[model samples]
Every structure is written in structure tokens, then in C-alpha cells.
Target: MASDAGVPDPETQSLDADELAFSDEGIEATLSPADPESDIAAIFDALFLISRLAQHNFPARIDIHTFAYLACLMSIYSGQPANEWGYSFSAVPPTLPYSPTLDGAIDRLVETDYLKTSKSTDVTNLAEFELTPEGERELGFFSTLSLLSRRLQFLDASTSAAVFTSSAAVVNSLANEPQLAAATHLNSSRQLLTESSTARLYDEFEALSQAIGKTDVNLILPASMYVSYLQSVMRATAEEATGEAVENA
Candidate 1:
């Protein structure tokens, strides 16, 4: 059930508290907020804006899990030093990391009518949500802010607008992220993707940026290439696995 304006439903309120505790403990452990001008501070602000942007631009109704996962991906692609973003995710088997901060943001948005719950047909029975008309209006207001406008414009210029708007492409890219493969290899149920874990990804983007040269390059250009690389990797992996299965059969 959806909540009234300014009041979240009971389930949402409970989720909000739990998510807040998890985010505060997990993120604060990795990112110190003592320095206002630090990269960590910038990453946090970008994370906030990116999550809202993901919500606003998603082409269809999204479940909390999917929304959170996509927001994480968008944060990485937003050109911030990924290592400075202190988002920690616990590996949920057969899915991407469960991000407490992003999840909580969804609840908060629901409370403010920026998002609303929808019926779920999937077996997981998780409540799905869609951005409210008010949410679009709110994003319009945010677009007036220079920081967000720059980020949005960077994305628009760098990547095909269709990519970010497509749910399948977003999920496929995340599933194929090299970091996810590393986490799977660790064989841990509670694998935490820490800041250090993102160092390689950050480095990869940095390298791509340098190769492209700074004068006319947008951060999203490197980001789009990174995502495409991962997608191709997934396709190749799937083919390899299928062939091996055929041989065994």
C-alpha cells in the first residue's frame, strides 16, 4: 500500500529505520564526514542526486531492489571517484548487492510522494514502485540546479539516451560487472563491496578518461564504454557456459 503525503506506511517506516541504521553504520565506517571539501563529501552529494535521477528517469515501474541496484550503477558512472563513495552492499544470492542507503532513499521518496507503490506480479512478492507525476515535477526543479544540470547533460551527451532508460540493459550491465564476478568467487554469503573494492573500477574509468583526452571528453563517455564492455563480457560468458554444457551433454 502507498502512503499518504508526508507519512509513510507502516512497512515503509520500519524499512526506513532499518535501512538508516545499516547505511549509517556501514557507510560511516568507510567514509569519514569530517572534511566538507573532501572527495568523500562530493561523492555523497553525487550519490544523492544520482539516485533521484535514476528514479525519475527509469522507464517503468521498479522494485526497491532494482531501483537500488541501478542507482549504485549510476553513481559509479556519474564520474565521481567511485572509491570515495562509501556505499556498502551485501551480496544477495542470485542478485546484485543490496544497498541500504539507496533502499532508504526509495522509502523517503515514497513518504514525500515522489514515488508510489504498485502491484507486484513476480514471485518475490516485493512491492514495486513508480515515480509519481509530482516526482517528475520535483526533478524539473532540481534540473534548475547547476550541479544536477551539468551531470544530466554529461550523461545525455556521453551515452545513448536509450541505454539509461532501458531496464534490461541496466540489469545486464550490473550483473556482468567484473566486481560482481570477484565477489562470487569469494564464496561469501555476506560479501561487502567496500571502497577499496571499487578501486579497480575507478582506475579503469580514469584510464579511459586520460586516453580520450580531457579537452572534449565527458565522463559519461568513459562510463558508457565501461558498461558496454561489461555487457559484451556477459554475452561471451553466457555463450561459453552454454557450449560447455552442450559438450558435457
Candidate 2:
């Protein structure tokens, strides 16, 4: 079945299995950067690769659309804006259509064993998911791609807003919690993520230990959380520190 754009719409082609006209040789499609339909394929090559790796390694049924959706969620989960994910029903940044997209994407992933979902009955009606061992294994295969894709996709001014808005909201919510702020400020003013003046290094264990300081309850935070908080706080502190240093000078 030929689509309006002259491509065989997969849906239509699937409907009439007997009339399917494409063979491996006939299935030559390319990403056209100029075409709206193809723009996504071009931009999301890396994200698609992440999902593709999972599908290849595990039994994940990751279609292009499913991959894009999961990558979008991961972007959000990783602190990038929805725009960087480049997904919107109406075509705009952070403009999500509804929960169906997320639900379906998660369902597809979970059913295929590419992801695992668990409920925190320790809390009231609370549930969250983490990547399964299979998911993590697949992620490791494309770890660099996943990392780079998340960063590259949000390499725009909009990322600052997406990150900052949530950052500020979180900081304020914990405003009364001075221990965290104290740890935050101390960690930030030192800029500990990097090594000293001449060395390059990171201490994952120390960072993760600090992050899990309050694990009596049911919760977990990624080690990256501390780095993000420290970095953001340091950015603000740097502005003030520079102004003060200049005044002193």
C-alpha cells in the first residue's frame, strides 16, 4: 500500500499482508533533512540507536516511535527539556499531549522485559520504574550514545530553563532542610566534580554515599543528582563569588 507521500505506510502495508509490495531490496528509505517527516529520523538517529541496541540485545519491540518516546522520557528523567527530545503532537517545546504516550511507551517496554516497573507500597499508591538488568545492559552498549544524545539534544538555551525551573523548585522545596543546603553549598563552592588544578578525576563512591545519606525510606537517587545540584548551585555561587572577588580586587 502506497502512502500519500509515496512511501509504503507500514500500517497499511501490514493490513494487507498479501498485497505487501516491499522486499528487503525494495525497502530502501532514507532520511531527508528537508522533509518534516524525515527531520525526526535525522535528528533522532542517536536516540533511535539507543532503543535499537535494546531491541537487538533483548526482545524489546522498539519501533522508531517507541524509541523516540522512551528517549524523550529518559531525556526528561536526565534533566533535559522536552524540546530536546523533539517530540510534541502540536510541535512545540515541553508541550506534551497527554499520558497515553508515556503509558503506551512504558507498557511496550515493560511487557517486552526491556524495562521493569515496581510499586512502592511503602508509600501510598506510589509506583516508579527503573531499567531492568536487560535494559541496563542495553544501555551500557549504547551508554556513550545515550549520554551524548541527551547532552547534544539539549545543547540550546532552552535546556537552561528546563533544568533551572526544576532545580529552583526542588531547592526551594528543601529550603528548610539545611543539612542538604549545607552539603550542597559546601559541595558546590569546592566544585568537586573535577580534579584539582592539575589532575582529572571523580569519586563515584563518595558521591553516591552522600546521595544515599537518608535511605531509611524507600527511595534512591542517581549519583548524577549530586553533581547536577552542585554544578547548578556553583553556577549561581560563581556569579556572586566573581562579583565579590572583583570588588575585593
lDDT of 1 by residue, 18-102 (tens): 1211111223344333332232223323333434444445322222344344344444444333333444556554565555554
- Candidate 1 clashing pairs? none
lDDT of 2 by residue, 46-141 (tens): 233334333323212222222333233223333233333322311111111122233344555557676653443454113344566776665555
How far is 104's C-alpha from truth in model 1 (Å)? 1.0
Off by over 4 Å in 1: 1-79, 83-90, 118-126, 145-165, 185-195, 210-216
TM-score of 2: 0.27
> Weakest 10 consecutive residues, lDDT, candidate 1?
15-24
- In model 2, the Cα lDDT at residue 97 comes to 15
Alpha-carbon shift of residue 166 in model 2 (angstroms) = 7.4
Task: Give the alpha-carbon lDDT of every model.
Answer: 0.46, 0.33
Rate residue 126 of model 1 by lDDT: 52
